[model samples]
Target: MSGLGDLVARLLGRSRAPVVVEDPPPTAEQIADAVRDVEARIEGRVPAAVTARVHRITGTVEDMVPRLDRFGVGDRQAYTVVATATSYLPEAVEGYLRLPRDFADRRVVSRGKTSLMLLCDQLDLLAVTLEKISDAVYRADAQALVAHGQFLADTFGQSSLDHPGPGAP
Candidate 1:
């Protein structure tokens, strides 16, 4: 059948295949909801240092959500990174949090805590990386802006461990 004939048939009766549409990227609120939920779940249970890291991580995500639009990603790469970080980290944290603190299986609790610690570290890096990416965006095409690493350190007051160290070549 011709294109016009197919259209007419679909309009009148219907087509067999379903139509698909692209899902809109998550909004800042949706991202904030998951991040904050994880924060609430883990409150006061972890060591003070770990708690501080979680606080910093969640704060960075909160900051990144609104400023995502200003990122120079141009492609969907930026959104994908932010969405994956926010979604995966929170779910993993929630899983760890959901485990009973006094569970009989010491081995299971140990493993869960270990995994949560690792996930929290990864989440920290992810948030810092997003901020660095966004920082680069603001620095783009601007003469006075310093390099990304510098910008990140200046804004966040510290660089990720993965970044070049102060004394490193």
Candidate 2:
């Protein structure tokens, strides 16, 4: 017998046909349901303490970053951090926020808005979820934002770090 036949015979202990099974492709509703499940899991995981920490971190950012008027950010545009948060969250958040509808084709730019929002949203979600899971809360301080910014600058560069001021590259 050929090697292939011999191997098959040995494995099967006789000549048995292999069974095949096919799974149906997921539908759009199924996909949406899965996404909703994931969102619910995330929401359930986040705790009150984590929410507070995230709130504090956001407050810190608000305090450190100049107001849009002070920085001359356009009224037509959303704040960088808010944009970033929206972008960073699942695309669902952006869709929910109706950003495309609101902003139209104005080109908000990733660095200008999406990235910052995403970072803040992700950090806040993680902190909240983890604290909820563990039943423990940890408060973050303004120093944490400074440290995070410094770390980003060190890792990337001053040019890459998102600073809310004119001439910030």
What would the per-residue lDDT of candidate 1 be over residues 15-112, giving only the tens digit for each residue? Answer: 65577888776767888887777778778765565577677767767766776776565556466446654676666566656666444213343446
- Candidate 1 error regions (>4 Å): 1-13, 21-23, 71-77, 102-113, 141-169
The TM-scores of all predictions, comma-separated, are 0.58, 0.22
| Residue 137 lDDT in candidate 1 | 59
User: Under the 3 Å rule for N, CA and C atoms, how many clashes does model 1 have?
Assistant: 0
lDDT of each: 0.65, 0.43
RMSD of 2: 21.5
Per residue, candidate 2 scores C-alpha lDDT tens digits across 40-120 of: 533533344433544443443333233233323442222333332233333433343344434422445565655334444
Model 1 / residue 123 / CA error / Å: 2.5
